[model samples]
Target chain A: MTQPDKGPVRPRHNVKIVRKNNRMEIPSSLDYLPKVDQFVESKLKKLRIKKDQLVDIAISVSEIVTNAVMHGNKNDLGKKVKINVEASPSQVEVIVEDEGTGFDPSSVECRLDPESLLKEAGRGILIVDSLMDKVEILCGPGKGTKVKIVKLLR
Target chain B: MKLSSRDVGDVMVLEPKGKIMGGPDATVLHDKLHEFIDQDKKKVVIDLAKVDWMNSTGLGILISGLTTLRNNGGELKLANVTDKIQSLLTITKLITVFEAHDSVDDAVASFSK
Candidate 1:
């Protein structure tokens, strides 16, 4: 017997996302970065932010979350990365916390140094700082890291 | 992000769509660039016209490709960088590190010059 046509065959994605209260939690893995981006972008889009400002916010959030996952949590699958977003007409704030021993924020290398120009990494925090209006990094040895960034809508 | 590549003369043009924020998707572009390098097709042009926006991870990937190619006696250039990415390059001071062109044709033509 011939099977009924289901139109064009479409690929299926087995994606499981966890979110609550304008926040999201994911295992410390870069594989979940897109989910974080999607969650944050959805929240910001509702505020009707300008396209450029929205992009800036999204980029800043991605940078913070990446650091949380890669550096703060050391990509430990057992650890968790939490992202909380709060927004208003004038500004948006994002907080990403990781469950791992943190490092000195001042230790972050400056990518603008001539010697570091071609380095493949160490640019995320700088990019985040440049894109957001205010950035607060709270972390220390044996303490988990929490990065809070605020961007003023233009 | 989605990546597609085609050859324009001796130059390889890579078109990556969507956001290049990190994750498994970002690795696709990184691996593709290195794969091209392994195949000895090193003169590369990344067409950023279709990319909506990318975080520092994307920029790192570009730098990785550029440095790898340069070290191997090849080179990488960028074509059609969007406003958002242009701003990013400027803020990060990477604007001086890359060769950007108005179009893929121009970028391709540049490899000959």
Candidate 2:
């Protein structure tokens, strides 16, 4: 059987990305969001995930990664965000970790509230939770944040 | 994301193709909307037909545009919202916030009504 197409091979920028199989590490900056999406999606595509499920997983990854870059790592270029993917025939799991002090996840405001509906930020985690089949947020002060999201392929 | 805009009568229709996940890509869409806002272009429609998907960042941008436009006595609408984006809007309850139409023409015409 021919190997699956991995999409385009774009030229790497100045951002140092360490890629090994289904794992990738990058600097903590929003500039790498697209790159992160590309890396994760290319891997998921190989699994023959349905279009809708693929988009759902892609969106969730984007949300978690954005949080890892902005809130988790404080967008400090010195810090780094790591993304690892594990896929089986029926599901895919993505883990995004950042090197920074973590905050209380319960403190996250509910964007669904009428008062918070207009807020610009703060919806990343909410969206991820809505899309993913399983979401595990491991965080603590000075321990960094690790968001693992799992999506079932149907 | 690649962004382009055009004017239909008094309404500005902005077309953004590709994912609108956060970062500089999101900034481009945010800036373009504000540019029109600063120009006093009150009516706007974002065509989302080409967008494969977007996360919270995209939603934030839409909310920002909607609130800023309304605050300035303008209005922002959505045209051709894809199924994925529609699901997002529904999940986030933003579906109730903005007026979305089936097509760009419908959105532009609604601005007059």
Candidate 3:
């Protein structure tokens, strides 16, 4: 959407979009979020994925990346978030890795629970898991959580 | 994200165009929701027809608005729920919490009843 009405692409920080070794890496800061989303969307478009599927994958990417930026890298800005995408004609796989202390993904409370429903957080994982066909949280041993997500293209 | 609002009788319809992923955009929506509360507007409808998609942060903004409005005896409703968002709500079990409508007109009409 290069429409002038959409305004200039935000460059509010030293956010960088790198295309190296078939992967993308961004600083672990919220400032880089918009750029990351844009890069991911463009890559998805190149893969010829349709609209509805694109939205789902985009939302999932944002959720995990935000967690990596905030919870994983703790917004250090010095650390970096690495995103790798491998797509075939039938499905897509995305791996987002963060440089921060990892935690148990299972420990997160269900947002669907009545007691937790109104809480304004903790729903990112839920959304990702629901939208993607498969998700694996690879973390521990001081290695940051690497979220691997797979979704089938319809 | 961009947020705009207009009055439909006593009800207010808010149109947020673009992605509500988080950061400054999320703050805009949160601040505007509180602004409506400060204005004493009891009924609010967030038209999502233009919203491409939103992450958990977006969902959080909606929940924050809904709970805050309810606390103040006001109410928040959603209209033009996109398929991706609808799926998020359904999976989060929020479909049971928020009152969602198919259109802005219908959402505003519900406030009257």
TM-score of chain B of each: 0.98, 0.98, 0.98
Off by over 4 Å in 3: A1-11, A15-17
Q: State residue B52's C-alpha deviation in candidate 3, in Å.
A: 1.4
lDDT of 3 by residue, A87-124 (tens): 77899889999999898876876645688788989888
Which pairs in model 1 have colliding backbones? none
For TM-score, candidate 2 versus 3, the one ahead is 2
Q: RMSD of model 2, in Å?
A: 5.8
**Candidate 1 — which residues are off by over 4 angstroms?**
A1-17
In model 2, the clashing pairs are none
lDDT of 1 by residue, A1-154 (tens): 1222222211133444569989898888888877787788888877878888988888898899898989889987778899999999889999999998988887887758777787778888888888899999998788799999999886
1 or 2, greater by DockQ = 1
Give the best candidate by DockQ: 3
The lDDT for every candidate, in the order shown, is 0.86, 0.86, 0.85
Sequence-dependent TM-score of model 2: 0.93
Give model 2's docking category.
Answer: acceptable
Cα error of candidate 2 at position A148, Å = 0.8
* lDDT string, candidate 2, B14-99, tens digits: 88888888777788888889998999998999999998888889899999999999999999999999988898888888888989
lDDT score, candidate 2, position A112: 81
lDDT of 3 by residue, B42-69 (tens): 7999999999889999999999999999
Q: Pick the candidate with the highest TM-score.
A: 2
Off by over 4 Å in 2: A1-13
